[model samples]
Target: MNKHFLWFFLLFCLGAAAKSLKCITCHLHTQPDRCRRGFGVCIAQKHESCMILQIFQDKALQLTYMVCQQFCRDLTFDFNNRTYVHKCCDYSYCNYDM
Candidate 1:
């Protein structure tokens, strides 16, 4: 009985550890050395991914942002001659490079 209890405890701890999701977050006019906005742990009830978004105008990067998302869909659209790109991932700090 004691051995079973210990095994259950260990598994419970492991399960808890596996559920945490960390992601980098930032908003910048241009690429920066680090996430100047901040880093955050994902806690949204249905959101299990991180996202990085960029918008460009005249081939120059105009805006960028990172956030936790429910789903990461690769999407592109244009408005006012600016192009927007979005990338999403499901690992800790996956948006760090964006």
Candidate 2:
């Protein structure tokens, strides 16, 4: 029983950690003073490092958001018609609309 509990705990932690992987390779090098929109489209910077890790579950539709930064956020989409808003802290916050 203890072993099973330990495994479940670790899995939970890993799942949460993977959801918020940072795009440091792309966003960290950007100018700190510029107002970069989602995917940095407004700054003329080409960054493709943004990603949404492990979001799909079943065939159902959903909306999700990710935190971008202290002053920005990101949006996600699915088969639904609602706009999911994310704060700057969530991992999917920097993902661009598709």
Candidate 3:
């Protein structure tokens, strides 16, 4: 019984540690300072990185935001001639740099 309790306690601590990734989230258009939107903790399945994304329209910056994501790959996509660029990193509050 003691061994079982010990294992349960260890597993509980490990689970708590892995449960969430704290990240900063903001949209430049809505919150210009990029800090007013405050922080959010992500507990989604497979989410391992914090991401910063910038969307540009006709080479002009339109929007900037951050989120927690499962994949940490820099990517770009275009829609209606607008370009969306995403930069991602693993570690707490890493999106603040972007």
Candidate 4:
């Protein structure tokens, strides 16, 4: 009983350590420095606009082709795979939701 308990405890600790390392690796590549979320970009926008702008940054020009090819999945008018599908701009006198 003691041996099995020790083995299980060690395995749990190792699994936790591996998860932390995985988070660090993915965050280092996909996120910027000075992160609060510690793994994603910090974009400030109106709550409505965040989804639209995020898509542009992720997909780029391919946003125009919305046929959902093998490369692009989860297509939507405003969001794609948790990213926004268009650019957001601050233009005076115009409140477009793009």
TM-score of every model versus the real structure? 0.68, 0.30, 0.61, 0.23
Q: Write the per-residue lDDT of candidate 4 for residues 8-96, one digit (tens) a residue.
A: 99999988655331111012122232323323322222322122212344454322211111122233464434444433332221111
Clashing pairs in 3: none
2 against 4, candidate with superior TM-score: 2
Ranking by lDDT: 1, 3, 2, 4
Model 3 off-target regions past 4 Å? 1-20, 27-39, 43-47
Question: Candidate 3 on 8-75: residue-level lDDT in tens?
Answer: 99999999887556677664433344444545556434746888888888888877777777767899
For 1-98, candidate 2 gives per-residue lDDT tens digits of 69999999999999976654454222322222332333332211223234422133253223222222343434455434344333233234344432
Per-residue lDDT value at 61 in model 1: 78
Please give the TM-score that candidate 1 achieves against the real structure.
Answer: 0.68
Top-TM-score structure, candidate number: 1
Number of backbone clashes in candidate 2: 9
Per-model C-alpha lDDT, please? 0.74, 0.38, 0.73, 0.31
Which stretch of 10 consecutive residues in model 2 shows the poorest summed lDDT?
Answer: 39-48
| TM-score, candidate number 3 | 0.61
Question: lDDT score of model 3?
Answer: 0.73
Candidate 1 residue-wise lDDT, 1-98, digit = tens: 69999999999998977777777666553543545555454543465588888988897877788878776788989989999999888777787665
